[model samples]
Target chain A: MSAIPQFGNWLSRRLQGSAAASNRRGYNAARHTDMAAEVWVIVRIFYAASLMVSFAFITPTLWKIAIAEPMLEPRWPVFWIHWVDVRLGATVLLIANMAAAFFAAPLYRKRWPRVALAITFFLSVALMLSRGYVNNSFHIWLWLTFFFAWLPDSDSRASLMDRRFRYDSVRVFVWATGTVLLFYTLSGIAKFIGAVPMNADKLSSVAPEALAHLVTKQLMISGDESVFGGLLVQLPTLGWPVYMLVIYIEIFALFALFRPALIPVFGWALMAFHIGIWFFMGILFPMQPLQVLLLLVWSPLALRPFSARGAIEQLPLLGSVVFWRRTKPNVSLMKFWWADEWPLFTVIAALTFLDVLPELVKRLLAAM
Target chain B: MNASHSRKNRGAILPLIRATTREKELDMGRKNNRFKAGFAAILVSAYTLVGGYGASFNFPEIFPFFNWALFSFPAKIYNEWVVQVIAIDGDRLSEPADVHLIDRFDHFGAGEGKVLREWGKSVEQGDLEAAQAHRSLFENLYRRSGAEQVRYRLVLRRSNPVQRWEHGTVLSETVEGEFTWVKDSGEQP
Candidate 1:
């Protein structure tokens, strides 16, 4: 019996050794996979960082102008030159480029989307540099670009892209949170420290005059006092709450990115606040749209784990392929699989062609 | 029979050991990844929050040279030196008069001429000098009026030439010259 037990132990030891070798092989493979993912994340992050820095500089430029030259009268001729047309064109181009990247990321299985995205990125930088006008509108584009660029797509999960994306996302979240907090804390401190009276009676009486002056100084050519007077009368009753809320929101915004549910609520509140300012005070921060986009795209911590898992699971296929598979789960009926998909591909190709056609025409016209 | 059985048992044990080791390695990797991510998050968050705190209270106008160690010290000095000057000069007669108060005249033009033009219609004709004096007194309220440009035409002949002053000429006319200083009930100057 003793001899038999010894023999059994020996056999078990040999089996264990073989299994250990197999396990080591699997571990090596997983490590390699993770390293590859980290590299891709890094690249994506670098791209995001460049875009963000470009955007930050651009935003401040607009603020500087607004502060330096408070537009008392709407210079319509200069408006198109300074504010509207250039921005519209840049926004359209950026949106189109982003759309293309989204579509092409999964298709073609090439780096063209990266190149295209990079081009759009550069275009945004150029727009900021060339365009002097800064407002909430420009900010919207910047935030939108940042959000979309950070989305967990195929490129982001690629070995070279994962670490970059992770690092960049963390960095961006920190920067945004820091900025909001700074604004909030400083505003709060100012209100508390500055001798500006915060009483309802004082605010009601004083705020309207200030608002009127601001509007007359910044917007209306005639320097209409009535609009501001009306707002002042109404705002004083509401202004204190709004002022308090502004501080509250900024401080709270730091946590909103982590808590996904709060984002939509906060986003709506911010939009309402901005719109109210625009309508009543004629003060608009052009970057509100970008902020809204950020609020919408900010994934909640609860959802992040699932999304991260999904990203891992969806790694084998490109973003478009995953989207297509999800959208058309029952498209296995055709006799010829590739033939059946021809219609979809054709539509996508047409859309793609249409998108690039304008640029092509412009280029051709320039050449001629 | 015994040897064969022993060999079979050994083989089974070997595979199990290998499998267990693999699981342990994966667990370690997952733990390490989590630790790094957590560390990065903490670093980013702390840095951002602290930085933001610094930025928010850095408004120049409200807290000019406000050091945390000597909060409100600058304001006190400013009030004593700057505000006192304006008060003593009776420069607070203007609608909004303060150290940082921005007047329209400063931007467009400011001097005896501009002051006279603004108050000329408002003041009684007999009290024109009084109005001028009031204006001059108000002008002395500010530390210094920002610079202004002056333009004049010198027509020596039919060909007129315009001379422009970019730096601006100073308004040094005395308030005493602009208005009659009435004797007070108690004393006369």
Candidate 2:
């Protein structure tokens, strides 16, 4: 019973310490921003490599369909297709898009190259999708590269603003990491929604049979059979636990923003999860796992082993419980985790509490 | 005096003075941190609201901010399409053999399967014009399979993944269509 009070006091101390750390990370703009810039440059180089590799991916198909394949019912107007002989244009733009990614990666520090790369990549992918060869892999890169391109390039000479407050590279990092996290989290939510009976309000338990069914279904559809895929079908319930972990990780991915520690943890978990899918399902979404690896698992922040302990200690409510230490509390006010001191943290707790507590509190008060 | 215990005299007042002094140091960027707090609120809300809207519905083709409905479609039973290439030796049907057409377009396994199914559906309904668009893609696939000239038969297979896995059973299979082509310089044969 006495330990409960100790837990509260420890939590209060941890929040105060974390608030200080977050402030330091924000205030030391040069240090953190430079780190982010370094990561940006590396990702740029990798993006370029990805584009160069696509040369092989694109040439084989050769957009023969552009001239021969019908495009009568494109999702959007085939204006780009109509602009310059669809086959010639797709060939030229795709080659240029890959070339641009290669060049843009190295010269991204220059403004025009970065902007040009974004637009060209967007156009090339959009053009391919418009031809109705839509792919899940394309959409993953489609959203990530385009939106992530907007993150502040600290070294860019061209993007030197006309007005607004200069967003430091670290904030840009949060925005980017947050975006990736949001992608996975919502995907998990989508799975939960899927588990429910169509047009129903309740979520049914995930049965082993269900996962087995999914494995069997993918194997037959793709014809890219794997012994592991066959095993999932044979075991009937081998995949539910693994499937559950994947859903939980994806759903809780955004919590990494508050904790910052789960960055590498989730990154590695997702990468492994993706590899499992590729081997078992024969559906290779190569770009998505690669992006998660680059942005989350191997980011500069994630690699900071010693300093990250402090960040790890800021894992919302669990930090204090996991890493307890005695500290004398001495401020004009007692610090609270869900308060102004830990503003970033407050949002997560506040949103959750607002939904559950405020209504309950209001009723309690009324009863009183 | 336990060695593992995290305690220092527990008197509490001496550390209190030290904490008071530390608070003053922490105040240097107090106002700036308030800005981070505000931005944090904005960031969380923007992603959840916008991305959540995309998730709750099915407008995935909208690009970057699309739904993540990867395997959300529940699967006890599903459909699989197979295209078997039959060799054309002279004027006779050279006895149909099982050809894994999917292996020909192995770069993107799942998507290529969907494309094959769409073309098969067109053939089933006698929509040759609609099917014409996919012919070249299939032609390239056939060429890659080292095919010289062949008749392609589309088969529709339906089964429960778990039942087949558990009991080594399949529900049903039916042939959808049979078609062939020949052309020059990257022509279909």
Candidate 3:
């Protein structure tokens, strides 16, 4: 009986030691993940800074050209230069930034310089301002790229104007909501004011009449019916309601930012809205892209809970020999798959190939 | 054994510190990411909405100040008027209508007839002789055919109105008594 008691105590001590070791392992793993994430943030910041500097130099000149020249002049040299500079610059920067994020292991070893960081931030803001006054669609993308590039890292402890930037997520949510609301309100006002002189009775007909005439003239010259011609004709009576609905959607989307549950619904609606515009009006607004980014942001948070539950439910399955054998049993897979040590060159090469394929095809076709 | 225990303690402490730092960093990172994501969302949405509006309306410029208020409607009006005038001119040149008759008078008033009458000395030099000879020929032909005043009413449609103007000197010759002239088997007064 004494031997039996001693054996029971020994088993208990062994179990306790194992639990402590497991806890330590888990802590170590969590610490490593945190470090990796910090590195990613720093990489993103540096990339953003670089892009901001580039944009600051380029955006103003582009703006001047876009404003001064007719948009559809069919000037080949102008078109080629603009297309290559804008699209290539943005794409290359995005790839570089993402690569930096994936392979942030080196960044973790060193602290980012405050002066350099501040300069980047200042340049980004300056780039934003250069085109903000114009309210061009391109500016939105530029601003977003800048914003994502400089998004605060885990280690940033500095306060803005001596006020700690707390609840940054909430602030972002509020800002997005407010901005969308403001835009919606402004748009509604512009339409209403513009159509006011026509009187209520003729107001509905005004846009249709104007659009029809414009379309007819364009068709006479080009022999191509505009995408919006049919829709514009059908929408004469529903103009005011349609306008109001657009405003409502914008405002509602802002609200959905706060209540993430409504996101899928709003996101779908927004997608549909963009598709409708594309088909009916032949306008490719950046709303779809924005929605995609929003979905990406919410993905980690919303999917985390469900995934956690799934992991818990499959804990027994994870312990099975089949699963263990299929995975690297002898080697720790986690150690081999450090997030910060991803091959930047591979990613860059892959992206380059993907981006260059269309151009390569075109060139080959031309040569042939 | 003591040194090994101390080393283990250090290892444990390092992990705890790292974990705490990581947690703080993650919290801050998440906050910033969230804020930026939201800001970006709003900006992009606004941009799209504005772009859609500009495209649909065919605003002269995408900017609010340079839109329809500044350019499009005015340009549209100018283009419409120019097109209408061009269409009218094209219609006139393609058909033979009252416009051709007006063109004839326009040619007579503006061409050789005006110069001859204003600068020449006598009726022959002035082209008045040609007009008189034609009038005399027409009068003789009418008299030989026994034609009198040919009465005609100028009718104009209500929907298509025409304006006419007349200014001329009239000559009257009065006879005190009725005189009969007999020529062969015909008598005319």
Candidate 4:
């Protein structure tokens, strides 16, 4: 929280035409152009491959969707899912979804082509949400594909030749970064607000039993018991410190977008956090870590090798040290007014809508 | 973009080292600014609409919009629900074993485990609606498992989740309840 202003100041100093951009003499500009071409390809491949990896999560539910016997009650009661099997031969549906992922880059050019992808994309969503199959990873990856499609493919057109790259690549990169951070922050808000002192009277206290209950239930439900998970739940406290660390990482994750070195820092922390959830409970979200690999690790120009620092620039917290001794980054961030401001507004509203306000609404409606 | 001017003040955004496009970008200058703003606004609008009290669409649970709600509620109600589906033979119940019901639902099986835990709670509270719904679900599982013609026992156990092992008691948990879904012989209790 304290370092937020510093990141903003770095962006501000450059946009305000301060001494920041003047420090560009430290590196070569041509190499950066070639790197963008490489990064452009890497981002797309990483994303498409993530879709293929979703097979692990998707495979087990094949029989559930295939059998035509719906859940006891569908989560949303989507008419087709509950009544008629909307996914005709869910096996065929799975192949279509995987095919869409592979065809994404070639298909996103203009009009007639995108429709083919959209049909398959929506079908994947239906398959994912059917038979009580709902997961956070599914939602995040689906949206990433949607938002990332809007990003420009300037690398193919002209190799970051001039102003076209910002209009194309930079804008969407920032947009995608801001959008994902919104999701993480919203989830953090949901967890954080639960432990607020004012809400302490509730039977479900987050600090004491959030992990105990979740760890126990997930392990029990999944039938994948962990000795650590069992021992942790029976402890004197519910490991609130670990809980606080997660909330802090998620809420602050978006700020990593502002500074290059910070991306991998938050990226590593988030990936570790996701793995921690798997260890405690049998749940696994292969996409979250994979997506983090795209956004923070491989995000264009995010932690792209520092001219002076070699591959060390890609390391987690240590990467920030590459920027530490420098006067300023040779690579200045272009001002993204709309992309920058949306996250601030969305995060506040997401917190309000997800937590306290809903409690207020439920109470108000009850009172009336 | 002035080639000479870009040579002097190169824009370091995006691909990091392009002076040539900087001037053209500045010259074109926010042509789609309104479009960008509107798109951001639309995303925020759609987001707020689909949400509810820790869930989505005013339903207790919904896809994608769900918060995963870990630790927000008490998990003690059903710490471990393996749902032993044992068969009943002449005056004897078959040996207890885990039912394949977990495989029938949940991508990772935790989703079904979580629900059966909820079912256990609802059953404890005498939730008739839940029973009606769960009866159909279990009947489907029984039919799929080919466990007809013999009565089956659905037993739930508690693992003493929050408490420590008292005096090294290996048997910390006991069968909390039993449910019967008799297929034939008109034998349900």
Against the hidden reference, what TM-scores do the models get? Answer: 0.34, 0.66, 0.32, 0.67
Question: Please, what are the lDDT tens digits per residue for candidate 2 over residues A1-368?
Answer: 24434443344334344533442334344545445555665567556755654565543444544544434234342355675676687777766767676676666654465566667666666655553345556555555555556655445533334112134544556667776776676666667656655533222336555666667667655545775887776575777898888877776676665555557777888888788887777766666677778777876555345345564455445444323432323322334333423543443344333223433554577799
Q: Using TM-score, give the best candidate's number.
A: 4
lDDT of 2 by residue, B67-146 (tens): 55566555655566666656452344455544553233223345456567667667676887757766555554444343
Report how closely model 3 matches the true complex, as a DockQ value.
Answer: 0.01
lDDT of 2: 0.56
Q: Given candidate 1, what's the lDDT at residue B96?
A: 19
Q: Which has the better TM-score: candidate 2, or candidate 4?
A: 4
User: How many Å off is the CA of A125 in candidate 4?
Assistant: 3.5
Instruction: Count the clashes in each prediction.
Output: 45, 2, 1, 2
Name the lDDT of candidate 1.
0.35
- Once fitted onto the true fold, the runs of candidate 1 whose alpha carbons sit more than 4 angstroms away are A1-123, A126-140, A143-229, A285-294, A297-368, B1-189
Error of 1 at A80 (Å): 26
Residue-level error in angstroms, candidate 2, position A83:
4.2
Global lDDT of each candidate: 0.35, 0.56, 0.33, 0.52
Local error of candidate 2 at residue A103 (angstroms):
1.8
Q: Write the per-residue lDDT of candidate 4 for residues A1-368, one digit (tens) a residue.
A: 23433444333233211211332333345655654555566555654564565455554454445554444344442344534553455666666655555566454433232334445555555554543324455667656556566655442545467645634656666677767866776666666655654433243445555566556545544446664686676673656667667877776565455445556667778888888877766566767787777777666645444333433332223333443335334444223323333444444555556445566767788799
**Candidate 3, B1-189: lDDT as tens digits:** 699999999998999999999899888765655555445534444454444444343312243211212111201221110001011212323422221133221111111222222222223344655434332322221222222232111111111000000111112222112112111122222
The superposed Cα distance between candidate 1 and the true structure at residue A14, in angstroms, equals: 49
Please give me the DockQ of candidate 1 compared with the native complex. Answer: 0.03
